[model samples]
Target: MTDRGRTALDTVHAQLDAFNAHDLDAFVATYAADAVIVGVAPDPIVGAAAIRAFYESRLANPDLSCTIDDSVLFGTRWVVAQEQVVNAGVATETIATFDVVDGLIARASMLKA
Candidate 1:
């Protein structure tokens, strides 16, 4: 893979690792300050702080965990992945699109499947 592709994939892996570990600090660090998250609520979640707050509640659940089932990296900026998320004993599948810029996640959009 090219350096840019490797960097982008690395950032994606880091974010997933942090998320699976439920490490709020590390998870938030993988995102840009102005990163936006969509499909979690009625309106898009803007900024890292809001993203942190949004995840805080979900991560607080002890039964929450996500596993990447499949993934495809497009160029050096986007990663489209299929994930299996389990929360409160319920398993749900989601397709997620992540945009990486300068080694940080700039935006993420998730769609339930």
Candidate 2:
């Protein structure tokens, strides 16, 4: 993989790690200031502050955790991952796509896997 690809992957990994650890600051740090996230809610979550607010409620759930089943890097900026997420004792399979820009996530989209 190219350095850019590796950096994108590393940023995604850091987001996942911070999420599982419930480290709000670290998780939000992986995203750009104006990042947008889709599929997590009815409307897209825009900006880092909004992303932080969204995850804050989610991280409050002690039963929330995500495990990656597989991941692939598409070129240097896009990453797609199949993940299994457990929230409130219910498990869901998710396919998440991430767009990384300048070492941070610029956009994220999630779908049922």
Q: How many residue pairs clash in each candidate?
A: 0, 0
Q: Kindly list the per-residue Cα lDDT of model 1 for residues 1-113, writing each as its tens digit.
A: 11344477788788888888999888898888899999879999999889889999877777898988899999878999899889888989999999999888899999998
Give the poorly placed runs of model 1, Cα more than 4 Å off.
Answer: 1-6
lDDT of each: 0.86, 0.90
Task: For candidate 2, write residues 6-56 as lDDT tens digits.
Answer: 478898998999999999998998898999999999999999999999999
Highest-scoring model, lDDT: 2
- Give the TM-score comparing model 2 with the true structure, all chains together: 0.92
Which segments of candidate 2 are over 4 A away from where they belong? 1-6
Task: Give TM-scores for every candidate, taking all chains together and pairing residue i with residue i.
Answer: 0.91, 0.92
Clashing pairs in 1: none
